[model samples]
Target: MSKPVYLGKLTLFWCSSCKVPVLDGKCACGQKTEKMTITPPGDIRPAFPYDVNRINEVSRKQFGADMIRPDEIVLYNKAPYEDRMEEIICGGVILGTIRFETEKTEWVLMPRIEGARRICNTKTFTPEKMKSGELKNLIVLNDDAVPYVAEGTSVLVPGIYDVSDNISAEDEVIIITKKGEVVAAGRAKMSSEEMRNEPRGKAAKLRWKGTPADETSPEYRDDAESGFFSAPRTWDDVIAANRNILDTFERRSIDFIRNTAGNMDKRVTCSYSGGKDSLVTLCLTNKALDDFDILFSDTGLEFDETLENVRKVAEIYGKPFRTTSAGNAFWEGWEINGPPSVDNRWCNKMCKLTPITALIEDNYAENGCLTFIGQRKYESLARAKSERVWRSQAVPNQIGAAPIQDWTALHVWLYIFREKLPYNPLYEKGFDRIGCWLCPAASLADFMNLRITHPAYMAGLDEKLRPYAEDKGNPEEWIRYGFWRFGKLPPFMQHIAEAKGIITGNPAADAPAEKTGE
Candidate 1:
């Protein structure tokens, strides 16, 4: 499994007077604020294509139709040192998040109020809103049931006061007290009528309970602050704010490169992956050394945008681009070894490492090259603990060093923006990392977006997995859920499949045949 990317705890404060997220206890417009936590149904996943459509669909299905406005801008925010999780901000508040879970699935977790707004909030199934089909999923509790229905406690059927007419089992719901306070958010265990009439059984499973933050008391409005929601407007402003830090990083990286290369007798090269990190590395290497070549491993699975970007960067820098082809190696390996999984990454060996090794040997075998790669500690635990310089056993006579190992993703973006560098266009299109187009390590959201932007690629992938799935007695859901990408289902996925009564086939039988030609 890939290393877990840490997501920092997110907190949002509401300025009731300004009706906007405020950066400090006092807003720019000068309004007192109170803390408010909007908890979503699941962990936040990465934003995918047609996000508005998906949000609308969930609203209409779970609450009511025509709830969220089309003009609401979705802002993706990342915390310091955290790259795996992205918070989804709308209307100056973090209403939801896209989180990459341990199972490698990205889920969008939206708060109850956010869900209500998306579905047209009716203020807890009010008689008037009921006629207009608002508050479609709600659980009303009697006065006596409020305290017992705390976070993590299941709501019982007996103390039910009233409920929305359209509620269904497993529907996301806001649980309200008899006095009209939205005390908790949960999933309904039974339909509306069942929850109202049943004498015994759980009615709803509470996800979060009301806290002091949720209290309507007037005295608690002076101690809250919103962080990034009220950040500066322009990219230049952001760069300017961090200019000192950027300069420090730039100086340190340049020195590291100079010192490392000055002691080595071998040729110097930058392992250009065409991603933001590699691009930044290339810039720093140029500043440190006058003569260095570019080594690009064309895995054949690279995005068309990335291939073009490699050429563009090489041309601008006037460096000799040494390309090593992995032509059809990924497909050939997949055919012989089954689809590559996090556990079995033969595809990387075959398509990336093998070709790059040969390229080094064929060109610079006389003297090994010192390669600068764009790797950051924030990327993973393995990379976090890695040395500034090291030699890999997989490749002979080559030393690797990372200059920007301590920088964050935010720092990289700031530098790139300040320099006005032409980055890969895919990042603007919502791709976080650019690598093999069909990399199994990719999140489900990536594949979902790929399906929209590149249907033929998804079709080709499904075509390859269908036969393998069918032979193993696995249902089409195995392929649909991207389970085929993993040799063994991780704990989270296994639990999910079990809950849904989906059976995953035995992995031993699905193992591929012997290796083919290298």
Candidate 2:
């Protein structure tokens, strides 16, 4: 006879896909399904309820309230008695209360969220001066009761009697008995059904938490290299350095005007991409030099919204904006060679550099003119090498002045705040950098957020990229794996939904994956 299956307290019930808990008897997947609602076993300790307002305050303190929703709250709850572990059964928008001890000041549990397995402790989980011995005594693992687990072993496929409905591709989860005892901590290797069918390979990547509630930092990289660090310890230093940079820029600007102001004819132009840096450069130049031209080269792949923003800003400044379309030539080049990758960056050089060079050649003057740019030293390692004043080797006898070279991100934000400058709305929404929509340099989360926030933009990207990925092969994997599976919806979308008390039906609509053709 087959071994008796372990059915802990977790009850499987058919529910409406709309609300995973309210028994609707049918799932949107068209298959009958059952979900496990996490409930603690007898006398299981519970996390105390956290105030929603306190969460908002903490979020504001961590990440300013400039763009954050004022109503959003993030509360903390602790897993009840050390013996039983917490499991996140469902993943999506959820609202539930938790119970905890009132006297415990050091530990607060996050709101009871389905699929929000405790990934890491963020300062509040541990007791003051808590030790490992104290923690081991507090919690218990119901591994033996699960029957799917063996001591000193990895989580294999056959032992997984049941899987959580909300398992994501790379989400962290708790392995436990349906009775709510912690077995192991691990990352999900496959989705629920996939794990059941594919009875091979690893299922959950296991982890060991030595302390019951140790508030240790999560294992992740520093925010600086990841382009996620909006503020750093050296921000003040960077800000102080900006004074010298601004002075250098002002002096160079005057010199460029004095020398090239008369010589500048049709050839001299500010290359405008409608980016914050480029816009600042063109506006400054337009103010300083009369009849200076704004050169905008369209590569055919810019976002429609971005293009509109460009036009709106240009119209506002009342500057003469000249446009050069380079799509046909770029497509021709792609047909011959191939799509550009991050390492190649040939698309930028070929499509942008070639057209601008052609424009300069067509309008070359006897006296070489200057190109004022809003290039900043803090943009990347490449820009770090740039100076306040330097002559471009690409354009002989033409000088480039990067007035904002030494500015920090805070300075940029401050400048925009103080002057009420027009900027790409994308920046306000948390996109650190903006360029081609399909660029691979974008993080998976970034791509996911873009798709969820801007479905129309994603649709356009899909139409443009489908033929290309198909031509190269493994189109499905490219779409499913590279695009959808690992991608994440932007955090703000959920925040917005939470604030409005509405659920986002199509969270990944704006994803580049959705935009790209499979």
Q: Write the per-residue lDDT of candidate 2 for residues 217-242, one digit (tens) a residue.
A: 24323321222112222212222323
Q: Compare the candidates by lDDT and give the number of the best one.
A: 1
Q: Name the top TM-score candidate.
A: 1
Question: TM-scores for all candidates?
Answer: 0.75, 0.47
Which runs in model 1 stand beyond 4 Å of their true positions?
1-108, 112-127, 140-154, 158-161, 176-181, 211-237, 492-518
Please list the residue runs of candidate 2 whose C-alpha ends up more than 4 Å from where it truly belongs after superposition: 1-268, 286-291, 395-397, 453-457, 460-475, 480-518
Q: Note the Cα lDDT for every prediction shown.
A: 0.66, 0.44
| TM-score of candidate 2 relative to the true fold | 0.47
What is the clash tally of candidate 1?
7
State each candidate's clash count: 7, 24
**Candidate 1 lDDT tens digits, 239-262:** 554455578779999999999999
Clashing pairs in 1: 40-110, 44-97, 44-98, 44-99, 45-98, 45-99, 45-107
